[model samples]
Target: MDQYSVPAGPAAGEFRDRSSKFVAALYHVQDEAAALDAVAEQARIHNRCNHHCYAYRLGPGPDRWRANDDGEPSGTAGKPILGQIDKAGLSDILIVVSRYFGGTKLGTSGLINAYREAARLALEEVTVTQQLLLTGVRLAFGYALMTPVMSALSQLGLEMADQAFGERAEVLLELPESTASATVRELQAAIAGVYVEEVGDDFEVEGLTVLVTPTGD
Candidate 1:
């Protein structure tokens, strides 16, 4: 897919029932690693919480998702949170709900409702934005081709993720997937002595600490 909806930034929501407190945290994640990092971060922040239930969906695939009840009833916490994420039609997102038991038992139905409502509330506070899918490329060339390669990148409005100047110069790039092949062909045809190869699917804008919404196509 060219683009998909993701949270604009971090958001939080709270729910209280029978004196029990549920805190939900929402984050934009790029992959499973990022999702797990978010989960760990939440756990650390709520270290005293009774349980830290979480759910995450990555990419556009149906199978790229996970849910964890984290001590609540098997289906009570994690499933409800995931349901809210699916209902929102979002990807590259994670939701973690930390529960502080109030000494009163909410039972199965009550627990489910609380988690669902907490997740929904957190999502409601989020501003959704489109995340552009990009393909990664690595370029290898002699020092003589550096000037032309940089010029080509500038002309094509492409961003370089990294550059190394060793015996042979190397540059990393992020390109829109739809035009990645054409871009490679154009670069090779225009700049001889340069080798271009696709590295992977994931890409990040250089110097960006947070997920960015690329403007235009």
Candidate 2:
């Protein structure tokens, strides 16, 4: 399956009318069940609203889902919100549009337009990036080699996963599958063959690597 990723911040919008207020909630989610649960929770929190409608996509999963309208007309609230998410080519996301009733009632079309516009406006403020499958690596080396190694890493414009000091200081690094070999070669040369390095097979969504023990072949 393709990797999933999302912006770190919450996306929200508030729209108003003479008799109603609509607040759209957009969040980046990782799993289908979690996204649906979040939507349900929001609905409960805003239970006093006239309607709580939501939509979500879990990519190719059996639960790739979209729901809406709640107690309103079919395809009015939930479908439009989900449409907005699909239009943005986003998955693992849940959006709930909560409506507090005003004296006047909006027709089905009006509800659809309001929900769609709210979602679009909220998403406009988000900055999205592609998700990648990453593997982690940890390297142990002497203190004397730290400066040169760091300099080499800087020259290569590589991001360090982490650095920690102990009996033997360790440097954690993450590399994309495509660049792993090149990174290993560069590090090996920088330390002048004095470093102990290990690579793991695990994958991560973020660009940062979380260190794990390397597998013994």
Question: For every model shown, what is its TM-score relative to the native structure?
Answer: 0.71, 0.58
Candidate 1: stretches off by over 4 Å: 143-172, 190-217
The alpha-carbon deviation from the true structure for residue 147 of candidate 1, after best TM-score superposition, in angstroms, is: 7.9
lDDT per residue as tens, model 1, 6-59: 888999999999999999999998788998888899999999896999999987
Q: What is the C-alpha lDDT of each candidate?
A: 0.82, 0.69
Please list the Cα RMSD from the true structure of every candidate, rounded to 1 decimal place.
Answer: 7.9, 7.8
Worst 10 residues of 1 by lDDT: 204-213
Error of 2 at 144 (Å): 27
lDDT for each residue of candidate 2 in 47-145, tens digit (9 for 90 to 100): 888677788776434366767677888888888887888788776677888889887878877887888888887787776765654556676666676
Give the C-alpha lDDT of model 2: 0.69
Off by over 4 Å in 2: 1-5, 59-63, 134-217
Deviation in angstroms for 93 in model 1? 2.1
* Leading candidate by lDDT: 1
